[model samples]
Target: MTEQNRLKQIIEAALLAAGKPLSLDEMIGLFAESEQPEKKRLREVLAELTEDYDGRGIEVTEVGSGFRIQVRAEFSPWVSKLWVERPPKYSRALLETLALIAYRQPITRGEIEDIRGVSVSTNIIKTLTEREWVRVVGHRDVPGKPALYATTKEFLDYFNLKSLNELPTLAEIRDLDSINRELELQDPDKVSDEQPDGDAKAAEGGEEDPETQQDGDDAIPTDEIDTESTVKESEAEAEPEVFAESSDETDSFDHLDSAETPSAEDDTSDQQIDVDTEPMDDAEQPETEPPAVALSDEEQTPLKTEIDE
Candidate 1:
């Protein structure tokens, strides 16, 4: 077999013999031999080996600062069904705390607590210890010294990380914060109050345009007002006045058309003509008297009394 393939077989043998995940650093010493394989060469070989397993059931994954070989998660249920084994579940919060410590090893619990913003309960520390995920790496030399913790090989194996560097980037961490904040916004009740007032004020500050504000300032000369609102205002004002004038003229023409016109004669002449055209009086002609029949003396007496004769 070629040297790289030989190295791959050696690494695989080591993993199989070890029966667990191994750190690149730990694997480094083993790869160190009479040949004295360079770190770069080992990494390339490991990469080539990892790629070989891509389509296969086994995989090489990095967690914390190390690497391990394991079956892919998709096949877990089938493999688990055969073995009657289900892996232990780590609550996301607990995993976050563990990952922080794993990547930032020799980290104090206070710092972890600060990151978590809650007191670290004893059970959390104990569970990690029992699971062999974390170990008491060392203690700080500072005052009132606190114990420092670091992730173990088990953490690497569990997470399938090749090395601490292979752990997700710090940028990814910041993105996680953003994503979490967004999730918090998904809850309707806390959205308004949860956002910091200072952050909001800062956002409002960045968005403020001083020039725009200055444009709105009252100190501007009257010339500016005449310049800005003048055109629109003039158009608005002139249109209605023009419409009104046109309407007035139209109405005046209509009134003139519908007016009661005088006759061709002058007003005085018309009045004289009106007097000349009067009807002849009913009493001026004998024909006005109705033809009468003879009446009895009593009727004639009543009629003579009504006529005052």
Candidate 2:
């Protein structure tokens, strides 16, 4: 292979092998400094690799982090079947919170709550943080100085976005519902189930609040409705064994109980014998009279007189 062709092949292999996105610096490190290709040449190879995978099952794409070879979104439905466990579904509230953070980054929790017109659940924040989608950028300069959140590179990678600029414009979103629809089109893999939870339902019911309502141009997109399956066949397969083990435990307990238990007649006879033995033992003990105390004659006389009175 020519030097250029060899470089392309190396870049393609690196991206394919990398489970996560690889930055330009990391890709450059693959080659010795003396023989390393220029940054521009590396990018050109990456671009060519991306084109080479066009119309193929897997495609090389660039995100905020860098380049990665991933299965295209169009084939995810069929590809996802390989895994037994379904992806996690996010509630509308959680998605809305993420949307607000993505568009109006470095925003505080309070700001998100204000935009949504409902108190943001700690769990939603926790889930986002756990997923590494959002991070603590800094604290707002107000009384509480609430922590501000911004989207991480992982968020872009998850959504297959190259940058924040790739996000849909505010004008495209008429309302929260419209926003969700657009998001669904953009990321079908992430969006699952349209049915909002109790919190989301409540938020929707109160969406008419003036403070929470926004103009057409500024309105944020709502979470898309997701209807993906959550069941894992692998988990279902193991359930029978778990039930069998549990039943075995129960049977062992029952057997132990049967072995330790005495018959009703035996218990009654034992109790009666113990009662009879107790009375006999008591009867065998001799009864003792109280000891008499001698008192002085004068004191006795006074006591007798007082008793008589």
Candidate 3:
């Protein structure tokens, strides 16, 4: 092969074998001192290789880290099938936190929390750092001296981005839902919060969102428990008052009957005593008289003579 073609072949082999991005300096270092090509010639070779890969399943990509060979995005679906293991899923919180770092570099944790309106978890920061997607650029000049974060070249490389300029503008984002769908991250938190695309389409056709169903499943029981407790409490409170009032009324009626009975007995006994002591008219006298009545006849005759006088 010609020397120029050999140089191109060498560069291509270096990129494919590296398994990661390589800068011009790194590529040049692979050659001997006498054989190293100039930076301009290297860039020209890289550009020519990029053109050659235009219609292929794989392409030469330039990322923030430098250049690398990667499968074109269109072929990833079929290519990914080669691996049985699925990609690791990240949480929506983690994704959003990463997004903030990428979009607003040199931002502090407190600043991210302020924009998100929720506190960022330490685990999420640790995860991003561990992945080498983010790093502490510097500390803010404040009392607490919070670390300012920025996106690393690994972040750009993973996302297949050339630079921060390649990111979609805020207006172009539309919503996180669309972005998440495009990324196909399938974050568990996002999945829990949003209905599936099929369910969403079904909802548009008059079915309910699955998320609402899940919420109902969780929320309805709580409402029912509260309602049942309130009803039972009200019933319990009403029952005692009803029983107490009935008992009080019954006791009052018994007291009234007892008091009236003694008064009635006393009145009847006084009436009998009055009848025994008062004199009885002749018409009211007994038809049969006792023997004592004859002894009293002489006394009665004097009493009768005095009555006639």
Candidate 4:
């Protein structure tokens, strides 16, 4: 076979046997320094091998770390049966924390807490670190200098992502309200199905048929009816006391009204008296004599004699 064909076969065999992503440097290191193929030629061969696997059960793909041959996700159901062990199940909280770290790299734990609106559990961080999905990149240059975290290559490979840029945009990540609205729009039937029949009837504002109503009444237990009747009787017996209390309140309010009525009448009488006196005083003022009376001759003579003295 030609050298180009042989190179493709060799690369394919190495990827298959490695069972994990192999970096270009690792693949090139396989050959002697002098005999090593050019990086460009290796890439061309890798590309050819990827094309050859197209439409096949497996495919050659590049992840954040490097290249690997993995079974296509479409065939995973059938292929997964070959393994006796079950795949691990991750909690929603863990997945959310991981996504945040992946998208917002170099994020501090406090920052993640702020976004999630809860404290990050130590166990969650421990679990992700143990799984090799995340690692502490560095410390923030602030008070306490919290450690910053970033997604590792294993995280990308597991999610089938080539890089952080492959992640969904912030706009694409729907908020809880938008997600709930979308769910409501997508499958209204599902939401309806979850509701009880009585609630659905209430929502529709429809009355139950006579037969259904009779059936529901018949389904009530005898003891429940007795209890309900007893409650009604107790309420009826206590109603006289309630009415008596209310009557007492009414009597007190009537007393208050009676007490206030006299004062109001007194105020009206005072106002009326002032009004009557005002007109009488104006009318009498014109009839009353002036204080300046004409001086008698004897009084004038005494005043003149006093002035002369």
Highest-scoring model, lDDT: 3
Clashes of 4: 0
**How would the candidate models be sorted by lDDT, starting from the highest?**
3, 2, 4, 1
For model 1, the local distance difference test gives 0.73
All candidates: TM-score: 0.43, 0.56, 0.57, 0.57
Root mean square deviation (Cα) for candidate 1: 19.8
Error of 1 at 219 (Å): 48
| Pick by TM-score: 1 or 3, better one | 3
Model 1 lDDT-worst window of ten: 178-187
Q: Write the per-residue lDDT of candidate 4 for residues 67-107, one digit (tens) a residue.
A: 99999999999999999999999877787788778766889
**Clashing pairs in model 2, backbone N/Cα/C closer than 3 A:** 192-226, 193-226, 193-227, 194-225, 194-226
Per-residue lDDT over 1-309 for candidate 3, one digit per residue giving the tens place of the 0 to 100 score: 999999999999999999999999999999999999999999999999989998988999899899999998888999999999999999988988888787778899998887777899999999999999999999999999999999999999899888999997654565675444433444665567566876777768675445655553455665777999999999999999999999999999999998876777798998999998999999998899655645477788988899999
148 Cα displacement, candidate 3 (Å): 0.6
Separate clash counts for every candidate: 11, 5, 0, 0
For residues 147-246, write the lDDT of model 2, one tens digit per residue. Answer: 9999999999999999999987654554675445533433433343433465688797785767766798777644321211224555777899999999
| lDDT per model vs. reference | 0.73, 0.84, 0.86, 0.83
